[model samples]
Target: MANIIITGTSRGIGFELVKLFAKEGHQVLALSRNVQPVQRLDLSNVHCFSFDLGNPNDFKKVEAFLEQWNVVDVLINNAGSLLNKPFAETTIEEFERVYKVNVFGVAEMIRTVRHKMGKEGHVVTVSSMGGVQGSMKFPGLSAYSSSKGAVITLTELLAEEYKETGPSFNVLALGAVQTEMLEEAFPGYQALVTALEMATYIKDFALTGHKLYNGKLLQVSNSTP
Candidate 1:
């Protein structure tokens, strides 16, 4: 079984992924600001830790926590932030805040875990298609989208960085998935893919050894299978 690390696991897609991985018999290290109690869960492979991705300093703590452990087989950079404000009304602080969690936080985790990732390991970053081709009518997504773009770029850079390491690295550029984050931003936006499905795809993708997914955008839409 693989040892996996997933961020933003208190709720939404992150939580779904944590459960899914555990169900698949993988050891999961879930990190988020709030961790849900799992007394009802019979799974013995799950471990939760509270972490604020916005704090860049937390990377060291994360590394220290796993320093005594074996290699991590997968790292999912799933935590993200969104601020719904028009460009003219958005501030640098707001933008920076989003970037801190979305971009820098992801990079820090990869950096911290790079050495511990075993051969044929995986790194999946959940990016949005809005960030892939840029958004036109989707206003108020400047900060969020730009941050995703940065993740895509980093995914590409890391793909090359780890090319000779023999790991399956990729970035999943997802379409709208039904989650609390969407409701928080766009009260009633419909989604094409569910969080559970997204998590399943990621888990299976990692096992495929399809390195083309690395450094490329895989948009999840209604037509995606």
Candidate 2:
């Protein structure tokens, strides 16, 4: 089984992924700002790590933790941030906040674990359908969407960097999923897919020996199942 590191595991998709991975007997390191709530899980294979992903300095803490464990076989960049304000209305601070967590945060996590993940591993970044075509009009998504775009781009560059190696990097551009992020951003709007179902699909997809997905985007919609 793979040793996996998942960011933003306190709740939502990250939390669900931790459950699924641990259930499959894989060693899971769940990272979040506060992993206390998730620590109650009875899964022996799952370990909770608390830290702020948005801070680059916080990665040193993660690095120290890695010294105690084996090389991680997979790294899931599942944590994200959103600021629901129109481009004109969005403040620089808001934009920076979103990018800190959604873009640079993922980058730092990958940077910290890249050496540990050598050849036989995979890196999956949770992007969004908003990043796919940019034609769709979603008010206040400019900051968040652009950050996801950055993630997609990072995936392509990293995949090429590791081309000779067996490790793969891909982005799962999910459509709307019912998660706390959705509810907090779009209060009354219903999601097209449930987070639990989304997690299940991700787990199954990751397990599949599909090398074609490297440096590519996989859209998750009603037809995904």
Candidate 3:
């Protein structure tokens, strides 16, 4: 039904999202550093490609893909890097690496595809509960949480800057979901929400959320991991 681009589609919520959209007959571009998982699916109306959010060259792949279809109806910035180490032990390079994927990467993707998105397009960025101000904070997530926070601010600014032109922006500050990323961040912690559940919510929102929301930060958390 729409031309949608989703990152971090190798696993978790992103992977589920690809399936849902393609099953609904939408044109889907599924991007991930590891594309094998998506390739294995071989779903109809879906294309998989290897992409690195931290690599500038990889963005050209997105542009190349867009040559087939100029417009992007929806973009879900779902890729993220997490560092669970203590703040004191976290090096500057390590911190930058997280932001490279979580912060700067989101910015680059929006800038690269903004032209393709008209007033009706929507950009949904997946953030974490730790990124929300006054939300429950976690230990050993300085880099990861801070980077997510920055993306939220960036989304707000982008929405304000381009409100008149269209392509609204929104950020979803999610709580713990039972996904590999969550396990890597907090071992043995089981979240109430499943990856599929979150993915379903996100897909539904990305398709229609822009109609009512722009430059808004939504806290989508029910439990902690």
**Each prediction's TM-score against the native?**
0.91, 0.93, 0.98
Tell me, by TM-score, which candidate is best. 3
What do the candidate models score in CA lDDT, each in turn? 0.79, 0.83, 0.94
Cα lDDT tens digits, model 3, 122-212, are 9999999899888878889999999999999999999999999979999999999999999998889889999999999999999999999
Candidate 1 per-residue lDDT over residues 163-202, each given as its tens digit: 7774556888777788888777677777777888877887
Minimal lDDT window, size 10, model 1: 216-225
lDDT of 2 by residue, 1-225 (tens): 888888888888888898888888999888899887679896788877678878888899889989977677888889888788879988889999999999889988888898887667889889987877743647778899889888999998988888787578988988778888988767877887788899998877676533556787787765211
**Candidates' RMSD to native:** 2.4, 2.1, 0.7
Model 2 bad stretches (over 4 Å) = 223-225
Q: For residue 206, give model 2's deviation from the true position in Å.
A: 2.3
lDDT of model 3, residue 15: 95
Q: Report model 1's TM-score to 2 decimal places.
A: 0.91
